[model samples]
Target: MTVNDKLQADWEPKSDAVQRDQRAAYDEMRERCPVAYSDFLEWSVFRHEDIVRVLMDPDTFSNAASRHLSVPDGMDPPEHTEYRRMIVQYFQPERVDAFEPQCREIAAKRLQSLLGRDELEFIGDFAHWFAVRIQSASLGWPLEMCEPLRLWTQKNHQATFAQDRPAMAEIAKEFEGYVHELLQIRRAAGAQASDDITGSLLRQYVQGRPLRDEEIVSIVRNWTVGEVGTISAALGILVHYLAQHPDLQQQLRTQPSLLPAAIDEILRIYGPLVSNRRITTRPVEIGGRKIAAGERISLIWISANRDGRVFEDPEAYRLDRDPTANLLYGAGIHVCPGAPLARMEMRVAMEEILGHTTRIDPIPERPPTGAVYPGSGFATLPLRVR
Candidate 1:
């Protein structure tokens, strides 16, 4: 709350305009102030080039932006590399491949409950439900944990946006309790423990030492809450995007193989996750703004993915665009390790929806509600499923 910092504020991220339309606001901000400042998010980097620079050079823009432990995603250098290698096996091709049938089963069951309905609220009724169920099933969690995890994701987002450190800490501790209980269950089971991801984590070792409970909790938090939030938002965005774009929807329905590529492209155009935080290790200039060492900044993913400089006619949908340029799963050492599982979950969920229904159309009377900062996609998506 220094005078200089207050004076540097460029735009209000939670303004009415942004709340109404996040994409349009981000597009305008990226153009007007590529390196904007705000009280909420110290310095916001909106351009694709600047974000790519930040990602490629993690040494300069460190990912240890949180005060709490964040497993591999929020660590730096040597430490991140070690933890990353240990946990990546959970998302190996074989593991994710084995889970595909189960993922489809979860999606199908949710759809079956609403099969006869003409109109539905996709966000609450389907998107969040499916996201939580899939995450729970992946971890061998009981069906009862789904509702709690879904609610935890919501509360986590609220505390994050409000910058309520105490509330955030409380929820963090709550998540730790959940993980602790699960770990204890596995431990008690001994030789009969279910060999799921959660059980596997209890047996993981790092740097010649068994992984501590705190470390295990951090890892599960990154995988569960993070994936649940993003995957839910992503599914909502995909369904809403297809409903608005009939040509693409129909094309995908006919050429089902294109869904894998189509899902990434749609999410690129309308990102599910908003931004990631990084801190400066040394003074540097990005977008002509000089940032001092120890300063925190946000790389706006929603804006960066749609930067016209990188993707020609960035807003337009196209399959031919270069995949490497897209920062969907991010770039560099901190890139999302669970991308394989996430990709499979989304593809399977979308395939089930499209395969079972002939059309997904928007209800004229009930427009989708745009999620606020720190959360992307719709909060309430009312659509006609036929």
Candidate 2:
């Protein structure tokens, strides 16, 4: 019944299989051993309750699990809180509202451009393109920079997940150069009269001192590396599901007020984030298992979303499900601060697409390839726009 007992039971593949199929694998583990450990990746906390507990108590399950990938966002409370507050205001409702119309316009233009095409790959043609452009514009980056940034971000992620050290070093050098150039430009221009997110990050300070150059680089890298691909993946999932369920789509079209709830449901059903690992600072008991200090603990968000104990009809997607129970945006203090921005983008996108097209359906005989971690989702989601 304990974690050790479960570890003795059997070993499961955490990474080999494609993520979509891994849900069932995680569920099986949750039932047998919620706090499962592997020699390769430390312990995997699979249950909703267990993952939530760890998220809430950062002292016990420290966030400084790993340094390279875990940014300030992944650090523990006092430290995490400071970094978060530095820019939380930029994602406030008013700021999000200001960006909403722009987001809607972007979605409309993208949809218009691809309208009437025989087939359209939503991931590249729509999702990646829209997400990168919006992110670039939001931060006051040059419009021309979006494409190159997108390419770099993709390569950066690929190299990291692949664990290719040489490639990572090369890409990091390139990224450092890019951020350095941007920093110089901002320094020369002084503070502008605009409220752009990047400008705020540049002008903002912590503890009465400006954020260091490397800190700025880390922040921008995390934003692009963390957000863009996930948003694209989420978009692909949304389009895939919507295409499969014409009735639900029709209902949402008729009851457009349901768009927000529908988006929440879609994210809950197939959220972009997969799992994140944290290290134990001391021995802790979880799901009747004893996890020793210094062991890696993976909080599988995607698995928790499909947890049958917490969700009714866990496999089925229901738009009206209560949002309180969802783990899609994560939990505790480390929960995604960019959630409001992501929601705004998603809502505006769906609203625009539905307004212009009679129906959005999937193209049969062509399924997109799954992304490996640090990224996942459709390589090419060719959908019928009409």
> What TM-score do all the candidates reach, one by one?
0.98, 0.91
lDDT string for model 1 (293-373, tens) is 888999999999999999999988999999999999999888888899999999999999998899999999888888987
- The segments of candidate 2 whose C-alpha lies over 4 angstroms from its true place after superposition are 1-20, 69-71, 191-195
Q: Which digits, one per residue and each the tens of the lDDT, describe model 2 over residues 246-275?
A: 998888778889888887788777757778
Using TM-score as the measure, which candidate wins? 1
Q: Tell me model 1's lDDT, rounded to 2 decimals.
A: 0.91
RMSD of 2: 3.0
Runs off by more than 4 Å, candidate 1: 1-7
CA lDDT for candidate 2: 0.77
What C-alpha lDDT do the candidate models reach, one value each?
A: 0.91, 0.77
| Shift in Å, residue 295, candidate 1 | 0.5
Reference-based lDDT, residue 273, model 1: 92
